[model samples]
Target: MNESIAIAWPTDDELRAVGETKVLFGHQSVGADILDGVARVYAGASVAAPVIADVSSGEDAPDGTLMHACLGVNGEPLSKFAAFAEMLDTPVAEGVDVALMKLCYVDITASTDVQAVFDAYTSMMADLEAAHPDVRFLYTTVPLTADRGWKSKVRALLGGDDRMGPADNVARERYNTMVREKYAASGRLVDIAAVESAGTDERSQDGHTYHVLNQSLTLDRGHLNEAGSEAVAAELLKTVATYSPVA
Candidate 1:
């Protein structure tokens, strides 16, 4: 990480705005990491953080809370969409100012059909938006995995991009590109991938340059460490505060 470049933390007014917003987020472990960062952010600042709750379908969080749940099984991308749409159908989604679901890195593999995943996501989000016209649906890109080091670099040189690490990231990049193309102008995007890959040198192999999770940001292959978590969570809060919900 560059020590000279400063991260843009949420302003006091933005923090207050998000505090009053009722958000429903469906995600897996990385999402938990982000929520951890959210807590750290509020703790260090002079604002009261919103309530964070873990609830299931048919359960509703109190007003001014950020209600969240782990949705779908890993390796099953479509299931996440199904689970989130189902949640939107229940009372849990009532009066929600913002709602989104994030697909874990495990959800997309080298063999996964990125187009199919994108199609499912777009169709489901469209249905949910029509059903809950009052709620603003934020679209999130899938999280990314760190490059697998020497072996991954060699594979990139050999044009063997069919394995799990870099190839899977390629699939994820394709999906994220599609998402950005579709919703780039909508002002409802929370681009987790961009945050994960930022502030680091781009990795290149076989004359192709690509983005990967900044190794300094993770102790493991995919999950975020404290600093990484805080970086991503700050962007998330800042983005969430930009929306003015329909009155």
Candidate 2:
């Protein structure tokens, strides 16, 4: 049987270095906020004892064995983003053997442009493949949610209001649609939107949204509670089992 390795990289080159079966959890909030959700996503699935690993700052690296779900304990989003951006600007390196790219994030609604996001993602994958012919790429679509306040929080953090507008919601939906279409175009990619959407509905029915922090759902909601995270993790595990050969 072929061994499956998941390389959680912040950039395309670093991703390429690890070679295939790469799960790219793109730019979403990290820290304890999503730890449970991440775990659930990985644990709920049917993997053939697949290894879970992460590439974060020195402080955040997982202490367990390589095959035991490697978690980047101290990786900062800003740093990862900067590194990814830099690699996009430079040339890809050689001898990188990555297969799939899996991305896990909380907010992918109608407010973000789905096409543009996937285009950017696919373009990077294309570049890496151009440099190394043996590599294959797979990316997960941004999950769908009804949290309209997510945009506001992002905007406020950037010096704007704490309320999201209709346009923001529309953009997020568009982004989600784009992901669905793009992943459909490539047989290797995984469409996580279905599971995420279902999970979001479950959260709403429970009289809570996913972005509950400190026992209170924030106004600019874009986080997940323990229950919600568990749901996501279960869905993710299913996705992995379906796509990964090791499973």
Candidate 3:
């Protein structure tokens, strides 16, 4: 499978910094893939990887460990936002250096109101920023589902729903555009959609081409495979390694 840009391994100092950075990640299944990829990344570097712990709450998290947890129900974007906020109220947010919450592909559908969702997201993030001034909040684009294959297309033609197709990805792109516009310039964004779709697959619909999850990277319709996990985890680590908290 074609990869994106070459993985830039952090220097020993930066690696140590990554290990020392206290990060809280709220996500669903795909988040697990990224975390697995993180382990692969550190293993490839031949260094002792950071402590990764799955905790029920922030109070259980150890200092300097990358504590991750599943946030809210899938397909309910607002719930995820609220869950992240609730997570911040715990001790994890007290001295956290970096944190992010990611929405799964099922969170947004073709009929979703992108504007409304973006508005809710912005309000929640702004509040979190004000409440946790010491922590750096990272924004993530919503993940994209894979495009329909020829067989799936045939099924769709025969009146079967393709589950998630290009139309749903279009909605995700709309939200991703908002995220990039708000944070890309400030360098506080992790463009997961971009990484997943990079140099991989594009589906043209209504005379417009939209990036979709690289089929090669996914075993299912949405979740990442090993290669996909490593690809995204590399970017995630690079972002955390290079991040500088604002004074």
Candidate 4:
């Protein structure tokens, strides 16, 4: 993981000239804010392009995740859709150490077919890892179910329409469990979902028990409250600190 892999980043003006780059930035208080908070907590570590992929499909587009997206490297422009391969081809970049990035939460609950999601992610990860030996991608778990009304719970229990409920939580934990089983020791994952559910409650649905978000940690279903963001940010910092380059 060379600290000096300088990417050919573009200036703010250059980015403005292109239409594609405009859409990814300017989220007032969402994913990027949390990562920014994490960077602030770890004195020596920093987060760059704390943004989500502007591209719509996670499975097909390199821009589907922030790590895969072509981001404004240190507020300067690089190629619009430069993925990890592009980063590895050039000299070391300044904004982010291309060696590692947490693949931001992809909503597994959105897909009942968790195996397919994992298969796609695994396929993407394997290629990236194979091509860029210097790079390590960190996987993260989905946030706990924050939309747990009894009606929704019942709906989820039935396995029909509820996206966030007891069964959904079970899915979250199941996938997260697999992640830990596969990646924890190697430092390929940072379990932000664990922090999000710290001291959370457990409820049963159709003989399955799963975790729910502590109300303190959520603004609503699938959204983080201020405390929630802070907790996640700190945990992310802890993970970054472990593998961060020594100053």
Candidate 1 segments whose C-alpha is farther than 4 A from its true place = 1-5, 150-164, 205-208, 244-247
Give me the displacement of residue 213 in model 4, in angstroms: 1.8
User: What is the lDDT, from 0 to 100, of the residue 20 in candidate 3?
Assistant: 79
- Measured against the true structure, the TM-scores of the candidates, in listed sequence, are 0.90, 0.51, 0.91, 0.60
Encode model 2's per-residue lDDT on 1-247: one tens digit a residue: 1122232212322222222333333334422333455544445434222234443331222222111122221222223333443432332312222233333343333343445555666676667557556533445554333343565557857866432333343444455566656566665555544443442222322232232122122212345555544444444434433443322
> Cα deviation of 236 in candidate 2 (Å)?
2.4
lDDT of 3 by residue, 121-212 (tens): 99999999998888888889998877677888888789787548778888888889888999898787888998888767567777757678
Models sorted by TM-score, best on top: 3, 1, 4, 2
Worst 10 residues of 3 by lDDT: 1-10
Lowest lDDT sum, 10 consecutive residues, model 1, at 1-10
The C-alpha RMSD in Å for every predicted model, in order, reads 3.2, 10.8, 2.4, 12.1
The pairs that clash in candidate 4 are 4-92, 5-91, 5-92, 5-93, 6-91, 6-92, 6-93, 7-93, 9-77, 10-77
- Clashing residue pairs in all predictions, respectively, total 0, 44, 0, 10
Best by lDDT: 1
Q: Could you give candidate 4's per-residue lDDT for residues 4-101 as a string of tens digits?
A: 11112223232222212211211223355454543333333332433333332222223212333333232111121134334444433222332333
Local accuracy of candidate 1 as per-residue lDDT tens digits, 1-247: 3221245799888888899889999999999999999999999899999999887645778877889988989889888899999888888888889888899888877789889999999999999889888888899888888878787668867986634476677778888889999987898898988888876666655554656787767768589888878888898888778873522
Ranking by lDDT: 1, 3, 4, 2
